[model samples]
Target: MTDVAVPPPAPTTQTRARAEVAVAGVRVAPPVRRQAGAGPSDDGHVRLDGRGAALPLDPSSPFEVVDGRLLRDGDDVGLEVEAVDRPRFYDLATADGVPYEQLARLHGTDVLASTVIQTCIRYGEDDRCRFCAIESSLRAGATTRVKTPPQLAEVAEAAVRLDGVRQVVLTTGTTATPDRGARYLARCVAAIRRAVPGLPVQVQCEPPDDLAVLSELSMVGATSIGIHVESLDDEVRRRWMPGKAHVPLDDYWRAWDAAVRTFGRNQVSTYLLVGLGEDPDELVAGASELVARGVYPFVVPFRPLVGTLAADHPAPDPAVLAEVTERVAAVLRAAGMRGADQGAGCAACGACSVLSTAGG
Candidate 1:
């Protein structure tokens, strides 16, 4: 298939600025910073044009947030920027005395997110995903090893009551169980649903040996699910995520199909990390394929986070990242799959990726 080019949008638009900030990050220190954990972008959470954006807080970047506007080289860039205030829920603690902040942290402005299990079985140097720092926050004592269901329920209730958190994201490190941690996520989802009644929650994990676990999560009121396969290229998967690569692309496809059936179309999403050495055309083609299968392919840039194997790796060129986002976003728009319609999750939150900015 001949790949059609999606011309880069004009640089004067906020889409261009959003792409730049997503990759290059910004220079100012925001009130809520995600220094490291569970995912690729360790960033400062802010509202860019009143939408959530997780941008790297790099002291060296040319972009800076000044007085509610994004400035480039000390000049206004025509985009609004503001810090996301630390949530009121962070001030409270459980009866057992675990700080609510340690249990679940606010993502963007109102999304409550937690790594239910902090330690992944693939933590050994040889097996770790080069782009992931899932355990870094745990080792740094920023979060707990395991968040109990009741504890999560308590935190969920407080976040909703104290801060009006609209959605919750529950992600876990890959466990040894056949369900690969989905069952525990289901338990957490059930407990949180009971606590908040109609709150939307999204559960994320690796593809489980038992696909039934997907249905189990859905039955418990999980509004969405992320079965994140960072790269679709087998060679890139092996090179970047050696341990998770062993699961095979077929397993991921099966799980995604099952999830789309259970969670419904756009509710099933995956992370496609740019700059993992996958060909840009191939990456865009893979994203189009995902959309065809009723999955939302969340396109995000690769961040070389501290403590990960790829810590020193350079980020993808902003141009390349922007083009990929634009192309995939065109596919999403054609399929009528806006991330917001996913109900809840990373895609729904739209903080870490530029797809939302591109009208995905």
Candidate 2:
């Protein structure tokens, strides 16, 4: 029999990816301020929820917002966007005078996000990851080092009540415990479930030394998990995140295996940051390995944040970002994984990535 031919995906998907690249890699110009939050966007950014796009509307970027719709350099890009007001939850404070905004903040379109432990064990001058700005917001007093379960629960309830948030993503700085702060995540998940029983919550952390916490998380009502390995290239990991690199690749594989077993395929994921001086071809290969293990590689173009060693470094070129997204999106499609199917978390949020738009 003759081999079957495969038709390409719709052009709309590729077009979406290109738009995402433009938003992510380009800096918005002056006269435009980011609508809210400092965690990731660092400036005025908006999500094209209906069209499945998220981009920063900055001076340097080709995309802009005019009157209530998004345009590509003064032209309609067949996408619609509304200026999202600052989340209502930001205006409230915890009973003890700790602002709820400091406890947890809104991410993307409808996801409530928090870094449960804001300080990282590996964040010291010698051990810190060059690309991480985890503590910049913390030192800036934008957040607390740790969030109590009660505080998170309260914040979660208000976020959903005030802004209609649909999901929650709880992440933490890596701590010294063998659980790698997984236990706290479990507690936070349990608390959030108690407060919002029907809401889905996802947890992110370094792979814990104890795999049992993986099951504990699943049992406690966590809908998904992100065990990020920024770069698959060992050398890149060493140069960028020296401390995490010492953990070894085999350990990460072991963790991925356990996470997949516990959370199920597509529910487990990792962050693959490009432009860390790693070979693009190798980056694609690494993403492929992740897909083979039933893990969704949440590819992010590296952006040098405010206080990291790589703060002066530049983001990846749009062409490189486009290439990686298209390649990895294919892997996800073949594995039958879609970020939206995961129900909750960063991968589910899908704004920071182009894979979901590419039909992954």
Candidate 3:
């Protein structure tokens, strides 16, 4: 067996517990659970100490929730665990009978999110991101292949009316067109904004060939944008996200710069997942550059979900995750950038990552 690298110790007990539970998971089952889809995949939504947290429910884990507190080995871990109640909007359906749940689902407590296009061009085995299950939910019939702008608008209006959804997140599968699905996302953003004026909405997509689409999204009412690059290391990208790696880091840099210019500093974000064989120190440095360039590097641990190429891979060491998160959080703090300041999207929601807990 390969010797596991021992990560540096966590900065605090809370950080250590958060990191341990992030990978080992907890035994409690949350009411709102996300199985597999465009990810931060395979987790249950709950509030950890009154803050949103998406944690995996691994039966074998030592952690459990009792008396509204997180416990491990029969001792309180100083963390509260409250399952997010299922939203009222989930009960409604469209006029044509498509269930509202099929359109969009609640993330954390109030963030409504959907993958507008449930399929992707790079979903083929060889080119797929090793950690992505972007199409598995589609194949399982949990969601539709494509969601029209009106359908999304109708759902968004009801979600806001019935459940008081605070924000919306719209992401899509990478398409073959030059816009790479940004144009379609723009149209969806316009429809949702038209339906619920001033509701914060965040749109996520690949770096499009046309940077103009970035401005178009902002003009139409996107509160923020996430051009997720999962990893900044070239080798890690090529090995884990072969198809996306083809876009080149320069493309991501250009898109991030354009997005920052359009959406304003700290309004633009990207995913910087821990693990995936990236050098932890280098990863933190890259995140520093991103923060300096006005990009929020939303750091998250890599979960090995059920329906992905890396399903069998182990999660990063808790100590390593916590150490990395603490370091990245320092950089974000130094730059006066925090995920909640983004107003919408994953960072604002702050469930999938422990960065918020680290004060990022």
Candidate 4:
């Protein structure tokens, strides 16, 4: 996925105003470094540009960085944004020394990602998820709550040899174990595919009351799986996730029909957030019936992060996130779907949704 040459996209109303100016922000200049947990909320971080777009800004975004590109009050949205650096395996550490940025971080613009169990059995603020900040970066120490699997294959072989990255997302947190943690994410995807050979991972967890733990995470090497039911409106998942709205949406359609028969059709995705009070025509008629059951309703747009419980609340109305991203990008383009045509995580890293540049 790195031969380059991308460009012919923009214009779904300027890609919904560059994805609502990456969740309404553009006053930047410094202190970017952000990306809290369980995914989606760009209060700060992940905005790669170089023609492939990644989106997630607003770390106080006035969108500066002029000469290298992306200005604002001075205009020039002529492309070329910034903000996704900080890798180089975050200055290395592990050998049991920890601190490979607390065991994995780099998401979007090279996707290393990890939360391999940063504590949750629905973490308590009366069963969390009121827009989770997933342990607020493990209570501010920044990270590390349980990594392992050979410290995630020694930080995925030094983040694909010092940040050429590529793929791997992991994601955890509902662990009371019943394979709910998917057998330790199938032993960390068989120790990161025996220490990073083919690379493509994706895990994400939460619908696992067995069903062979989604075929043991596609026989251990993962390739894809999200299962995030951020909102299917059973009263907006019992008023914003009271312990994952007490499970049963027929167990997320029986784990989305055993994860689309074990990660096939559009490789099974799910995460339909958009302003959680729901009813954007019932969230596009429940994301067009989870895209007619092949799933991939990733629709995200409810950012209120800072230690969450809906932070101070407010960030989901860039005109209803461009009318729910043009009605879920026309149900991921009449279900031909395309978050980079998935072979990896988070709708193939369409970095917090513009639905892959609104072409879906």
Candidate 3 per-residue lDDT over residues 51-78, each given as its tens digit: 9899997999999999898999899989
TM-score of each: 0.97, 0.89, 0.97, 0.33
* Stretches of model 2 off by over 4 angstroms after superposition: 1-43, 49-58, 72-78
Please provide, for model 4 over 73-123, each residue's C-alpha lDDT reduced to its tens digit, 9 standing for 90 to 100.
667766666666667788888765778887777756777888888888887
Model 1 off-target regions past 4 Å? 1-12
Each candidate's number of clashing pairs is 0, 9, 0, 9
TM-score of 3: 0.97
Model 1, 227-331: lDDT tens digits are 999999999999999999999899999999999999898999999999999998889888888898999999999998998999999999888887788888888
In model 1, the Cα lDDT at residue 192 comes to 97
Which residue pairs collide in model 2, if any? 28-58, 28-59, 28-60, 29-58, 29-59, 29-60, 34-43, 34-44, 35-44
In model 4, pairs of residues that clash are 26-61, 26-62, 26-63, 27-61, 27-62, 27-63, 28-61, 28-62, 28-63
2 versus 3: better TM-score goes to: 3
Model 1 lDDT on a 0 to 1 scale: 0.90
